[model samples]
Target chain A: MWKAEIKVLLKKSVLDPQGQAVEKALSSLGYGNVQDVRIGKYLEVSFAAGSHKEAEDQVREMSERLLTNPVIEDYTFELVEV
Target chain B: MKFGVVVFPGSNCDLDAYHLVKDVLGEPVDYIWHQEENVSGFDCLILPGGFSYGDYLRCGAIARFSPVMKSVVAFARSGGLVIGICNGFQVLQEAGLLPGALYRNLSLQFRCYFTYLKVENRQTPFTSGLEVGRLLKIPIAHGEGNYYADADTLRRMEANGQIVFRYATADGEVTDTANPNGSLTNIAGVCNEMKNVLGMMPHPERAGEAALGSQDGRLIFESILKNWEGAR
Candidate 1:
């Protein structure tokens, strides 16, 4: 069994309305020091595979195929041995 | 026809879609959980719209990681018919099965109401029941429905006839106000290179019944069935 941790984020130039809303709310709460805020997601996936290379390949394929939107988001993954 | 509708934890449109297919269209359908891994047997797969994963992180961000997406992607890549409406469109974009990204409505508000769309290309299997330039009235409810793609990408889409729908008014006039989300070029929907995978922000399922004030959306499902039946 192998595990992969994936982190996904919107591209830098893309506007994040939810993040901006949270930032505004924070400012309203007097947390004025927060300059910039961006939001993203973290996912951990586990699958059974024969080797680290196979797991890595699967993880990469999954990221491109579904885990991340290459047009507006970027994703990276880390493998864990089980 | 055997159809599969993917259901995420926070998806509210699954039942709406299931009923739209099973009851309204009188077709057999199944509700596939997001964590399920296999989707090979279904004739069509639907990514119904809703606030998946409570719209956390990004609109369709978390839901994109669901295990069902793997099967969905594989199904689409194999030229299977897949439709993503509204939030489903966001998930398709977030899942990299379609081009462009959905930003918040230009006004930065959650918009919910009926809107008009122009059928841009009827050549695809999804829109075969409608003629090009026909107007369709559909409801759209979302905050992140504003579609954006780079200039070159937009040009390519136009050149390749990948653009399937554009926001329009009841009078068939294409205007910015008619475009609820301020999408680039007023695009409301597009398909992949194969034209089998469709992603559109308008909720066709919501407008399929006369009780909903319009049955124009039924043509889309009819189109799919007709095209598939002819192909087989």
Candidate 2:
């Protein structure tokens, strides 16, 4: 068994409308100190595999195929021995 | 036809979709909770509209991580038919099963009303009952329906003919009034490269009855049935 930590984030250039709306609301509430805000998702996935390399490969494929949208999001993963 | 509708905690439209599928379409359907890990017996799976997980983090953020989504993703990858409507569309985007994200309405308000959609690609099983360029009257209720995608992705989608629907007027005129949300290229719906997975923001189940003023939404379900019948 191996543990994988996956971080999924929208591409830097993509407009995050939800974050923008919150920013606007904060400004309206008189909090002008907020500079930049971007929202993202995180997942900790666990699976049983023989080796770290195979586990990492599976995590990468999962991220690309279903965990993250390549067109708008970028993801990175780290595998830990269990 | 046997169908399954995934039901998350905050899913308000699951029953509505259940009735539409079982009562309106005269098909057998079941509601599967979001925590389930299997979805093997159904021919079709639907993620209906509503504020899943109370729209807690983002529109569909929390719901995307539901255990049921794993099965839904597997089903879609295997060429099974899946439809995500309204909030369901947002879930699909967050789950990375579909391209693009549904952003806040360009006007920055929650919009709830009837809108028109132009069928762009009828080759898909979802739209095969409609002619290309035909208009559909459907209701849309969402705050994040403004679709956004990069230029390259949009070009690829267009080139591959994956765009299934565009906002249009009732008379089939492509106009801005019908575009409730300022979606990129006025895209209302799209399919995966294989055209088996569909994500759209309109509530087709809400328009299946004539008492709702138009029964046009039935055609979408009918198209799915037609495709399944032909495949069998």
lDDT, candidate 1, B68-187, per-residue tens = 998899999998899998889888888878888887787789899988999999989989889999999988888888898877888998988999999998988889879887788899
Candidate 2 per-residue C-alpha lDDT over B197-226 given as tens digits, one digit per residue, 9 for 90 to 100? 999998999999999977888899999999
Candidate 1 lDDT, tens digit per residue, A1-82? 8889999887876776668888999999999999988888799999998999999999998887666667778888899998
Looking at model 2 chain B, which ten-residue stretch has the lowest summed lDDT?
A: B170-179
lDDT (0-100) at residue B79 of candidate 2? 95
Q: Each model's interface RMSD (Å)?
A: 3.3, 4.0
lDDT of candidate 2 at residue B230, scale 0 to 100: 92
True contacts kept of each: 0.35, 0.24
Supply the DockQ value of model 1.
0.25
Compared with the true structure, all predictions reach lDDT values of 0.88, 0.88
